[model samples]
Target: MSLPTLHDLHRPLGSTGLTVSPLGLGTVKLGRDQGVKYPNGFTIPDDQQALQLLAQARELGINLIDTAPAYGRSEERLGPLLRGQRHEWVIVSKVGEEFDNGQSRFDFSAAHTRLSVERSLKRLETDCIELVLVHSDGNDLHILEHEDVYATLERLKQEGKIRGFGFSGKTAAGGVKALEQGDCAMVTYNLNEQGERPVLDYAADHGKAILVKKALASGHVCLSPGVDPVRASFELLFAHPGVSSAIVGTINPVHLAHNVATVAQVLKQR
Candidate 1:
């Protein structure tokens, strides 16, 4: 594909000065199978392919790559691939979840947070991560208010271990709390769920980046029998003025091409 135009690829993610394609890419399964079949599906990036996809993203004008500590080997895979080329884009990682027995589980203890951040930095091969978010779950909304955790994170920021902070979760309340209690610069959620409107709106109004997680709903729409509806949904979300970016992950090169093209169409219509 030719270089993607900012018209189709660009958005200012709040006050971070981290401009990126409104349609960002998330590497949730860069090293594992995500259990969904694509008409032209997504692919988990091998070590070599991770670099290639990132390079391709840059060429295509994408500058945000979302990953999390619970994403298994994704950060480790991205570390080497993105090493010296980190400046080419903004990297987002989460630290509230851990992979245990091949499943994802949450841990919000201050000690766990420190370990998670340290491991994430090592795997991402960065002394300082561009953005680190607390991966939130619905229960225990108080988790975001952990003074010990936020204070530790603030100290890390002061020490230059992280540039910014944020949270990724399923609700507006949790995200809002995170934004208020910490140095949060970004918040992520699934637009299809429509459960975090207030959180995203707050982030948008307050100049914090809002990144949509399941813009594709795990391919529920993309592979649905109704092609027009799928396309319509994509346009509907992309056209939202509040959404700074959407991480629509895919493996098939052609499908990824289709996503970028759809964003172009959405931009044209706007």
Candidate 2:
């Protein structure tokens, strides 16, 4: 097959008033982490190769690219590619984790949040990003208690440093707290891992946007859920009233084309 288009993944992000594709590209492994491996065996692809894959994503009509400093060089490697195509897409990144001297870890204080955004802005080579998510891992609520992190992001919003803000955790309770208190505009992850029905309901009721991060179960559920597992995985998130889109990654043009095709079929059904 020639692969699908981005029709279904493209939709308004709740009351975001901005139309976003239901499926997006996540840029986690396009960096140094590629050097690491598992006993299961396999080698990570090269950066140049990853960049070419990103180029293909653009051709496929993928409008959103999600990444984080914790993801190693994903943001830095993205700088060159994104600089030329600034207006062609929505770029989102996280603030909780950063890399230093070839190491990656978390820092969610107010100062760290500001520093993270600044670094991301530079790495992304953009004046302002479409969205800046607080990458909480599974610790979303702890950020709320600190106050500085949320306040800083709020200030960034007012200053137009970011178009909007969101939270990325692997759980629901933390998202619920952030959604209720921090004016968090979006929450990531979906029913597969989090089964965040309550939080999604809140976001829908409140007009907040909810994004499905691991909606396809990290490709673990790629097969059992639909006719063609990959294609069906792309559509499953849209079936939920809460999910706005998902961030799928690949350093392969063929996979990018497949993503586009799957999303296109979803749009047709909708």
Candidate 3:
């Protein structure tokens, strides 16, 4: 079956005034291959292969692309690879977390946040990042209220370094709190995990954008015989009007095409 273009999935990302495809391509696999949570280990694709995968994603109508400093050299590689295609993508990157030496570290301070955004800008080779999310270290409420991260992001937003900002939070309460101070929240919602539904509910009522992370449970969602988990997951996710996009990471063009096709099928049936 022919897959739909991203135009078919174009929708507003809440009240941010940003339009995004229903599915976003995540770039973790393109940058980071070590110490990942995927069920199996795999080789990270070379730039040539990565470029092909990205081209396939764009061809499939995916406009939103998510990456972060923690995703190894993802931000750096994307900077060069997405040069001419910059305007065609709603690029999403993050602050607060860094991956080095096969380990992860967190730094949500205002100074670090500023530096991170600046670094992301240089690495992405873009004048402005469409969205910059606080890559939470699972301390959702504490970071939202007590930390200076959102304030820094707000300042950056005002300075036009970032077009939008939000939190990839751990808990529903944290997601809600992040929304209170930002434009969107990246929550995890899939067939195996629905605990973040309340956050989606709040986003719906408040007209805030929501970009779903781990939408496929990081490829851990299991299905019974005769069941397709991708179709099931999208059906549940898009059923909510608040879901702006679901970020799926894959280095395989076939899987990317299948996912886009599945999204089309689910939306069509609905």
Q: Give the clash count for each candidate.
A: 4, 6, 1
lDDT of 3 by residue, 1-270 (tens): 666666676899888889999999999988898888998787889989988988888888888999999999999999999988899999999999999999999998999999999999999998899899999999898998888999999999999999999999889999998888789999999998889899999999999999998889998989998999888899999999889999999887888888998898888787
Considering only N, C-alpha and C atoms within 3 Å, which residue pairs clash in candidate 2?
4-260, 4-261, 8-267, 9-21, 9-22, 22-245
Clash pairs, model 3 backbone:
6-61
Cα lDDT tens digits for candidate 2, 178-214: 7765434344443345456677878777877777665
The full ranking of all candidates by TM-score, starting with the best, is: 3, 2, 1
TM-score of decoy 3: 0.98
Global lDDT of each candidate: 0.69, 0.71, 0.91
CA deviation > 4 Å runs, candidate 2: 1-3, 7-9, 34-48, 99-104, 181-194, 222-227
Q: List ranges where model 1 is wrong by over 4 Å.
A: 1-4, 7-9, 34-43, 182-192, 222-230
Residue-wise C-alpha lDDT for candidate 1, range 100-215, written one tens digit per residue? 55676877777887898899889988788877877766553666655356666767777888887776766678777766655443433433567677876777667777777767
Show the lowest summed lDDT stretch of 10 residues, model 2. 34-43
Clashing pairs in model 1?
Answer: 9-21, 42-250, 42-251, 43-251
Q: What C-alpha lDDT does candidate 2 achieve relative to the native structure?
A: 0.71
